[model samples]
Target: MIILYNLVLLVMRAGYNIAALFHNKARAFVTGRKDVFTKLGDYFRQNHAKVVWVHCASLGEFEQGRPLIESIKKEYPQTKILLTFFSPSGYEVRKNYDQADFIGYLPWDSAANAERFISIVKPTLAVFVKYEFWHHYAKALKQHQIPLLSVSSIFREEQMFFKPYGGFYRGILKNFSYFFVQNETSLHLLKSIGIDACAVAGDTRFDRVYAIVKQGGEIPVARQFKSDQKTFVVGSCWPEDFEVLTPLINENRIKFIIAPHEITETFMAAMESSLQVKSVRFSQAAGKPLEDYQVLIIDNIGMLSRLYRYGEFAFIGGAYGKGLHNILEAACYGVPIFFGNKDYEKYQEAVDLINRGGAFEVRDYTDLKAKYEMLNSPETFLLACEVTRLYVEENLGATEKIMHYCRTLLA
Candidate 1:
């Protein structure tokens, strides 16, 4: 199984290199790791400080781990932090994150790379967020007697660890010193598999979103566009999302703030063409009367999370195609949420929200229209708002729980 896994990784590396010829993100993934070891060695050698390393697979996992990272920095100001990502999306966006003392891409998961990386960084404590379960890295950390924690993790019965021929994968779980999982199902699943160093800590993303709500930021364009009217926020929208939403947007009953996942010129132009209502790009909104446009298209990144503050309702994208974007960002603002009815079961929050009536899942344009009308009722909308708010508040403190365990390890 180990050999097979290594072979698969090698094949993936080759495929990514080939895909880099035409794919921007693939190019980034390939080029970003060109001198990763040299960069890691240079930084670590210059600073012989006690380091805590946090590894996140992508941006989503980074959000789940961010509260813990910030908490560690605040509590142990002298301890240096090393943050690594496997995906370019995570590293590229957060490369200049000031909190982490060092940021780099994690070398591909191989025994030699793992041994070399563990020796170079010498992290006193290593934290893997959410779905990061690198086999060789976990083994290397255990051999070095370092405390490795898996935080905000969730397990399902269908995962390889619970399969009949999953002995090797189950061994990887044993390498972790402790697991701070998201729910009772995950806790019970681990115990069933004979892995007991775990507890239900909920999800750290709740803490992250709550913090965002408190430290409010200003977006004058979004505020002006939303003034004196109900606004629907469409965050992380892809073409699939737009296919179902274009009709509703054309109706122009309320204001809209559409922030697409990819802010490419072509996609933005297409999106604008699809809408019959008057619209303006965020970049082009300067000096123009924002209230004059029915649609305000965000032509940049980093503002979608904060834009939720100006929304009465939200439709998060990605479930129609791949995975869903972070719905909690809008939910924390007490906004009624909606999304495509696919690829969402893995996200426990989405499932919980649907069950609690805090969120709705629509199959297509008709489904979306019906659900929207149902929620339009004042009593129903207000109830959903309260549900979402309370859900976020109740899930608070996962980061603190995980931090208590981290304190013991760092001490």
Candidate 2:
């Protein structure tokens, strides 16, 4: 089985190199491992402080670990951070983050490469964000006796861990010194596998988002649409989300800021053509002051999470596809949220929020109209807003729990 796993890794590496000819992400797949080691070798020779290595799979996991990273910085001022990302998205966006002393794509997790990379960094502590589990990397850490921990771990039966042929993967779970899972369901899942180094630490993203909600930003454009009135931010939206929402914007007594997930020209054209009112793309309207249009179509990225702070209500996107967008971002503002019900199972926060009356999952246009009307009454709308805020407050402490656990493991 072990030999088969090695063969699989070899083929995967070879396949990735071939794919690199077409896609930019596969660049790391074919990089010279010796050169990678040489670069790290030079960096390591100069670093005198104990290093804390943190790995996050993508942007979502990066956000989940941001609060923890900042917390570590404050607590262990002398420690150096070696943050590695498996996905380009996280590495690209957060490469400039102040806390990470060294940020790069994690070398492909072959045993030899993992061992070489681990030995060079000499990480005093290692943290894995969310669900990424690379067997070679974990095994190397264990061999070096570096305490491995997972922050904001969430497990489900549908994952590879619970599959019938998941023994090789399941064997890797025991490498962690502790697992700070998002909920009891995940802790129970870990326990079922006899890997009980776990706790229900919730998610650090709520901590990061709630912190954002508290620190308000000037949405010079969005403010124009609101003008001292209630505004809904439809965030990280795709075409399907906009297709369902464009009709609702025609209704009177509602204001909107539609921040589509992709800000491409094609998507902006579709949004403008679909809407009933005068709409302006954010890129085009960047020089203009807020209030030039009834609907502000945000053809920009990086601001959607922060934009949630300005909204009385929010409708996150992605439910029309594989899962719901970041409902938690809006939830942290205590803003009531709405979304389609297509990919409902993947988003635990949405299900939990709707069950608590802090969110709504619109089944169809009919259900959307009913909910919108119910919120039309000023009194009921204010009540709903309060429910949303209260929900955020109720779930505010996950970061503290995670921070405490990390401190114990940090050098």
Candidate 3:
């Protein structure tokens, strides 16, 4: 099984190298790991502090792991954090994150790389956020007698760990010293497999988003653009979502602020071409009269969370394509969120919000229009807002529970 996994990694690395020639993201994935071991070794040699390693697969997982990271920094001020990402999406965005002492790409999951990495870092503890289970890395951590934790984890029966021919994969779960899972289903799944070093700690992202609400300050541009108008914020949108949303945007009933998932020149231009109403990109809005335009296009990243503060409604995109982006970012603001009605069942919050009447799923233009109109009434809108707000508040404190467990482990 280990040999087969190594073979798969080898093939994937070769495939990515070839793909790098033509793709920017693929190129980043290949180039970012260049001399990563030398970098890790050089950084750790002089530091020699008690290090806690936190591994996240991408940006979403980073958000899920962030509250815990910051909390660890606060409680264990002397302990150094080594944060690693498996994808460029997370590494590129948060490479310079201040909470972690060291941040880098996780060297691809080979036994040799894992052994070398463990030896070089010599962490007191290792943490894997959400679905980041690496066979070789888990084994290496166990060999070194390091405590490994799985945080904000969820498991489904369809996963290999529960399957008839999945003993190799199931062995990976046993490597973890403990698990802080998201819900009862995950707890039940692990218990059924005879893995009892786990508990339901909910999701750390709830704590993270609530912190954002407390710390959120005003974005001058967002405030200026909104300027007393009923605004709709569109976050992490894709071309597919835009196709369904463009007609509604053209109607110009309410002001719209769109932040596309990818800010590529081509996609932005395509979005602009499709919109019939007057619009302005955030970059160029500095000199223009902000209120003159009906649509405001966000041309950069990192402001979507704060941008929700100025909106009364939100459409979080990505469900129209691969999967749903983070609705929790917008939901934290207590807005009635809408998304494309596909592939959102995987998100527990989305399902909960839909059931609680805090969110709605739209299939197309007609679905969007009808559902959106239903929320136009002040009474109905306020009810949804309260539901969404209370939902976020109720889910808080997962980080504290996980931290309490970590205190015992670290002691």
Candidate 4:
């Protein structure tokens, strides 16, 4: 299976190389790793600091792992943090993040690469955030006697590890010193698979988002744009999200701030054309009285989490498409959430919020309009707000729980 995995990695590398010619993201994936080992080696050689290596699959996983990273740094101030990302999205956005002592792309998951990476980093402890299970990396860390942990993990029965012919994949699960899963279902799944080195740790994203809420207030630009109106924040929106939202925007009197997942010029132009109300791009909204425009379009990234503070209600995108984006970011602000009906199962918080009546799924414009009307009522809105606030409050401390176990293991 290891040999087969190596072969698969080779094929994937080749395929990505070919795709790089025509696709910008593929190009970035290839180009970003061109001198990754050399860079990592130079950095490690210059600094003999004890390292805690944290690997994330992408931006979302990075957010899930962030609270733990901050906790570890606080507890062990002298220890250097090494963060690695498998996806360009995470590395590109957080490459210069000050929290991690070193940040780089994770090399391909071949045995040789994993062995070399482990040797160079010499991590005292290694952490993989949710859904990142590289067989060679786990094996290399184990062989080095380094503590390896998987945090905020979620497992379902349908996954290969629980399958009848999944022994090879299941072997990877044994490499972890411990697993901090998100729910009881995952704990039960691991137990059924005879892997008892696990415990329920809830989701670290709650800790991260909740922390954001406590520290969050007053983004001058966002506040000015909102003009104290009942704002509707559409975060990480796609074209599909706009299909349902466009009609609602036209029919309603609510103010809007749209932060599309992609900020391509074409998409921004399309958004401007879709709305009948006066709208202005965030970058250009400076100096002008923001009250003049009904819609404020965020044309950049990194502010969507903070932007939620300006909203009374939010529609998080991606539920209608691939999967849901972080609904927790908005929920932390005690705002009711609306998203498309599909793919909500993958996000436990979304399901929980829906059950608590703080979130609602819309199939189309009709459903969206109806929910909008219902939530617009002062009593209904306040009830939704209170439910969301309680949900976020209940989910706190996952980071502290995971950190407690980690300190014991490290000690």
Candidate 5:
């Protein structure tokens, strides 16, 4: 199985190398690993502090892992954190994040690479956030007697670990000292596989978002743009989302702020052209009168979370395409969320919000318009706001629970 995994890795590396010629992300993936070990080695040689390693696959997992990361740092102030990312999206955005002591791309998961990585960093504890499970790395951690954990893990029956011919992957699960899963379903799934080192801790993202709510400050631009109007914030939107939302924006007298998932010039231009109302880009709106335009297009990243504060309600994008983006971000502000009716089954929060009357899943423009009208009522809007706020409030404290377990493990 290890041999097969290595072969697969080699093929993937070759494919990435070839793809690098045409694709910028693929190119970064290939280029980022050049002398990765040397960089890690130099850092290790210089810093002899006790290390806690946290691995995340990408941005979503990073968000899931963030509250724990900050808590760990607070409790173990002397311990250095070595944060590793498997994708450019996470690493690129958070490479300069000050919380982690060191940040870098995780070297490809090969036996030798894992062995070398474990030797250099020698983390006292290792945490894998969400779905990342590398066999060789798990094996190395086990061999080194490092306490390994999986946080905010969710499982489905279709996953290989639960499959008939999944012994190899199942072995990887055994390497974890504990699994803090997001739901009871994940706990039951692990139990069926005879994995008892697991518990239901709920999703840490709720904790993260709740923290955002408490600590959230005003974004001047967002505040200026809203300016007492009933504003709808559209976050992480895609082209498909715009297609469904454009007509709604054209018809409504309410203010709109759209932050697209991809902020490429061409994509922004396409979005601007689709909206019939006067729109201003965030970059250009700084000194200008924002109230003159009906739409404010966020052309950059990093402000979407803060932007939700100024919104009366929100439309979370990505459901029309791959998956739904984070509705919890908007929900934290006690706003009713709207999204496309596609691929929402995988997101437990979205499903729960729909059932709890905190969110609406619209199939198209007509459905969106209808839902908007439904929410336009003062009584209905207030009820949905309370429901969303309560949902977020009820789910808090996963971070504290996980941190308690970690303290016990470390003690």
Candidate 6:
């Protein structure tokens, strides 16, 4: 079965490479590290304890693992960081982030490719962020007696590891030295697979968000919204997400910062048409002063998380789709959160805050209006912000937890 899986992955790699040519992102990977996975085995052979491998499927996972990676770097400054991506989205956006010693793509998870890649990187420890489990890579790491750890792991029922016939991937779970999950539900899900080395680290993201907030929240963007008061930031947005709520946003009761999910021109134009307020485009604002606009459209990427600092509350994007953006990013500043309903299983933090009344979910315009009305009540908004602040203060120590464990292990 494993060999068959390996063969299947091998066939997929060739197809994926061909597929990469059509996608600028995938094309970037081939260009970014022409010899990355190709030279992995050789690199691994040369470096043993000096290397630590961190794998993220894309930018979201990269942010989830950022604090943990920073902690690891601080704890072991001399240890080199080997970061790998399986997607172009993450690689293209953050390929130049200074933390990693090396940034590149992982060849497909075929047996020969996985083994060869592992042999070259020669990671003393491999950290897989979120729930990205590559079967052959898991097996290869275990076969070589390398330590594997999963950080910020959130398990949904649909994942193969939790299915009734998931024993195959459960074997992969056993290779990990630890499973640092986001919540108790994920812990239970892992236990369902008979995987016990788990801890409710409460999402390394809380640590990341907390640090981001305290670290001078959002660099100077050189402009402000034309709001005297009551400004709302709609972050990581999709049109379906704004379908019912755009009317209220256009109602002029509040200001807006709609950072659409896609940076395409079509989406930006559609967003501008949806708003009644004088909507200003972010790209167009490059040469103009931004102080007079009530509605600012952030057409660029990398600014959503930072932009939260300028708002009273921010509606995170992704809930209208399969999932949502990181609520903790806004929550770190005690910013009240509102989102659509779909990312419930993946967003454990959202569920927790919603239950705690720190956040709310909107199904349509009515829900948005209700949440908006509540926000109008300064007392209610303050209470929500209080809940968010307390939640952040209480869970800001995940970095210490991982660091403590690493101290004992690396000693």
Candidate 3, superposed: residue stretches over 4 Å from native: 20-24, 224-227, 263-293
User: Relative to the true structure, how large is the alpha-carbon lDDT of every model?
Assistant: 0.93, 0.80, 0.92, 0.91, 0.91, 0.78
Better of 3 and 5 by lDDT: 3
Worst 10 residues of 5 by lDDT: 210-219
After TM-score superposition, the amount by which residue 223's alpha carbon in candidate 2 deviates from its true location, in angstroms, is 2.9
Candidate closer to the true structure by lDDT (higher is better), 1 or 6: 1
Tens digit per residue, CA lDDT, model 6, 296-355? 887777767677777888888788776887777788778788898666654667878998
lDDT of 5 by residue, 151-205 (tens): 9999999999999999999999999899999888899999999999998888999
Q: How many residue pairs clash in each candidate?
A: 0, 3, 0, 0, 0, 7
Q: Write the per-residue lDDT of candidate 1 for residues 81-167, one digit (tens) a residue.
A: 999999999999899999999998999999999999998889999999999999999999999999999999998999999999999
RMSD of each: 2.5, 2.8, 2.7, 2.7, 2.6, 3.5
* Best-matching candidate per lDDT: 1
lDDT of 2 by residue, 88-113 (tens): 77777887988888887788778888
> 1-411, model 3: which lDDT tens digit per residue?
778888999999999999999999999999999999999989997776789999999999999899988989998888999999999999999999999989999999988899999999999999999999999999999999999999999999999999988999999999999999999999999999889999999999998887876788888887888889999999998999999999999985689999999999999999889988888999988978887788999999888888998899999998988999889888889999999998799999999999999999999999999998999899999999999999998888999999998898665
Output the lDDT of residue 393, model 6.
85
Which digits, one per residue and each the tens of the lDDT, describe model 4 over residues 192-257? 989998999899999988777777666787898788688999999999999899988877779999
Using all chains and alpha carbons, the TM-scores for the candidates as numbered come to 0.90, 0.89, 0.89, 0.89, 0.90, 0.84
Backbone clash pairs for candidate 1 read none
Residue 42 in model 6: lDDT = 47
Candidate 6, which ten residues in sequence have the lowest lDDT sum?
A: 218-227
